[model samples]
Target: MAGRVAAVDCGTNSIRLLIADLVDGRLVEVDRRMTIVRLGQGVDASGAFAPEALERVFAAASDFAAVIRAAGVGRMRFVATSAARDVSNREVFRNGIEERVGIRPEIISGEEEAELSFRGATTSLDLPAPYLVTDIGGGSTELVLGDAGGVIAAESLDIGSVRLTERHVTTDPTSAVELAAITRDIDVLLDKTRVPLDEARAVVAVAGTATTVAAVALNLPEYDRDAVHRARLTADQLRDTTTWLTTSTRAARAAVHSIHPGRVDVIGAGALILQRLVDRLSVDSVLVSEHDILDGVALSLG
Candidate 1:
């Protein structure tokens, strides 16, 4: 049976809504958009959602609710990751969402987040099997290893764009010390990753960080999903882009139309995280995908 469904993914830095018609196990997109709410703002240090952050997220949720109603969505799922898991006042956040959206958001585990991200990134691609899918989000990064049969292994780490930047990046253009600290943190998490990186024949990276990097690498005048999706970049290209992003001033990075304004302060750390992952992979290049956990969540509703 075909049905219209909606999935809302509220992460540390942003919240996104995806509405699609599920027909024969495929998603016909209806509406997909994201807002930078920074829901996890100050969460790493405070262990709770900031008042302003909660306000922003609630506003986004209300708007999303309106869209869902207009789309006539039959089923909807809301999932919150990373910061939601760490926050002390989760019930406040949950109740507010349920009030506006008519359903509580699930604070999913890292493993589950990894699985959803893997499903979304691999579902539409015809790439080689035994793929390593990496999703670098705002508060955490998910790495999943799997083939056609399904996920072989997955792990989610605490290293993310906003989290790392909030912790390490205090200087403009990222001082060498700050960059080194960010690198060390990312390497430490990568060291603990359970997925066998060497087993992957293809590497597909999803979510905003990877997509933004791909856009910049392609030199698109603006953020073009058509051009960024499925774009492949070699290790050298990734390294160069990563270097530029990390060394460039916030003003310079914001000037790049492809880099989101919300991500300007944290993208350097995000790029560094992607660069380290690329360095670890045996493959010469990585494929970037715009489809991620939100798509997986929609598929699950069906």
Candidate 2:
């Protein structure tokens, strides 16, 4: 079956939209875009969406609405994660989107977010199982283990790039003290994943953090989805990248042709999370996938 659909993923740090055409069971991207709104800027401590965050998200929604309309999408779905889930004033966030886009955003559970990420990252690859899919977002991280039959186990951790950076890193070129604190927080959550990490034959990492890290590891002149997708980043590469990110100034990270301006401040924490996961899992390499929950959200529309 073939159809046209639009999918929107609103996370703590960014709002992304994917409009694609499903042709003979394959997804062809029509217009995939992202805007950093830092929706979860202070949600970790406040437990509410900041007024600025809400306005930024709504503005992006307004822009996405136009893109979605122009594409003539047959169906559309919006999935909000992490920051949206913990916020106390969700009604305001909900009403804003509903009014701007004419469609309400569904704040998905961590379990659901994990499943969708697994489905999207592994569907197009002929990788061995059980593949551990990791999606490091701004406010949380999702770990999903699955085989060809489908998801077998999934867990979401409360640690994320934005959350940890905001909580721990208070200075430019984060100090060792801050990095250590972030590491402790991540390690605690990683230990909580009762699923046997050793069972997975290979690992696949998805989302902005992973892709950005991959782009830097490859030393690409710029960010390219085709190059980053299915890219295998070795343990050494992860370690090296993490070191550079942790030790570099914010300007240095932002100067990287591959690093997005919005991710400059928090990418160091994100790299730490990925490196720790790689070290914890004892995997030789992690395969990066560009298709993640956003793609999975679009597929669900069919």
Candidate 3:
């Protein structure tokens, strides 16, 4: 209860674990883990968890729990986001987690997920008041508006990297026709999120897509928390990157200088969503934050 805290965010696309020790009010990370399990791979169409997907997620959870235990984490909590919230077999997965990993994950609402994302992005920021936060994840994109260090309004849209890719980009190369449909769909989601966009001073982007774009912008070969945690991207950069990703095949995208190899497949839809949001909102720049729900969960415990 007094040494360290661990939080795992089990998402549709990835499983992320953060274990940190709080010393003099500062959190020092003891262990961090990320695995792409794609638990909700085809849930958009099938409306049920695929067998492989379920197995992968459960295995990831089992590994994460072992890591936390090995690290001797003092306190911990696990939460599942959009994917778990939307799935009908959520209880089955939750029950399985308890049996397999000795941990029962809490399925958080979209609004709650957005709020946690907001906390992770801005809690450490020295930004101007009234910031906008958005986390474009696997199955949902969370948008939030807040003043200073606290959230004011937040909402989660059903558009995410996996969902968009599965729903629109059916072709191996994602033909222009498919790309156009994804663009149009993302434009609509942006329209709905504009309510929060209009109220904030600057946009703070978190989660995989946002951070992956920032990683690309910095031209880093691998993820660098220090380099990307507060990396900034302009409107032009966002638009250009979106265009570049949409034009390249998955292999070609993987060969890019900074893009992560695992992220290549879904980056196209993710970038387009980010680009449309920035363009439609007329925002000049966006800052990317690597800390997301895990960071929020760790801090809230104190």
Candidate 4:
């Protein structure tokens, strides 16, 4: 654990960390953990971090600070994305985190976010042709089209499950009216963004949303990347899974044999986002990645 550099991703929905020691050509993971902090709950409406959201982030970061210290990790690279970069109160949150977590979270631009996600996604796969990379986070989703060497086109969408669920879908089952509005918005983005799916040989999805869905497909009791990563999922199966998830309450979803307890509440929105992407692109199957932006950050820093 000596000379380990820790990379922390303070995302709108989750705070993730990767402790690694570079070994020749590969990155070896020493420790990793994700905490659901929902830091962007109403930032889209209020144009600032909500009071409760700020509190959740501070409380969680304090704990992460302790873990980092316990692991004997000294050098750290921390970045915040989406909601943090969008809202004006980023400094306020950043000040609090530096005071409590002993680290000032750097706000990474959308381009950097897409790059890290792409780095994590493509490096984990063996792509035959260029692919469209999709990452669904809590506050934002990134859609990137790229080749083997670098990114070609990438855009970050403000539409995330947490934001969508808070703004539109209120009912336990998420009524059809709300669902329609969200779908219309997403469909329009897909059309307007002009992402070329016809040329893409495949689609790859990274981050918690895609990996969690893959886990459910494989019926894993715990989230295991070895089983979940690169798990092939179809558009039909994606739709079917989302339909099944929407029927249950948060408690019921958590009670399901496959779903993670911390992921149950927000997963409905994640599934919807994934399903829409799959449908719009006419994607028959997609590759899932357990590693995401955090892993890419570690790689980049090396």
Best by lDDT: 1
The weakest ten consecutive residues by lDDT in model 2 span 191-200
Residue range 1-302, candidate 2, lDDT tens digits: 78899999999999999999988766899999999999999999889989988989999999999999998999899999999999899999998999999988999999999999988888868987888999999999999988999999899999999999989888887998999999999999988896678888899999999999999999999999899999999999989999999999998888898998999999999989999988977579999999999999988877
Clashes of each: 0, 0, 0, 0
Give the per-residue lDDT digits (tens) of candidate 1, residues 1-302. 69999999999999999999999998999999999999989988999999999999999999999999999999999999999999999999999999999999999999999999999999967878789999999999999999888999999999999999999888897999999999999999898778888888899999999999999999999999999988999999999999999999989998999988999898889999999988888799999999999999999998
What does candidate 4 score in Cα RMSD to the true structure? 2.1
Off by over 4 Å in 3: 24-26
List the candidate 1 regions with Cα displacement exceeding 4 Å: none
Q: How many Å off is the CA of 65 in candidate 4?
A: 1.7
Give lDDT tens digits, candidate 3, residues 124-148. Answer: 6887667888888889888888977
Q: Could you estimate the TM-score for every candidate?
A: 0.99, 0.98, 0.94, 0.93
Q: What is the C-alpha lDDT of each candidate?
A: 0.94, 0.92, 0.82, 0.80
Clashing pairs in 3: none
Can you write out model 4's per-residue Cα lDDT over 132-231, one digit (the tens) per residue? 8888988888888898878888888887777777777778776788778777766777676655756677889898888888887666876777898788
Which residue window of length 10 is worst by lDDT in model 3? 192-201
TM-score for model 4?
Answer: 0.93
Q: In model 2, which runs have C-alpha deviations exceeding 4 angstroms?
A: none
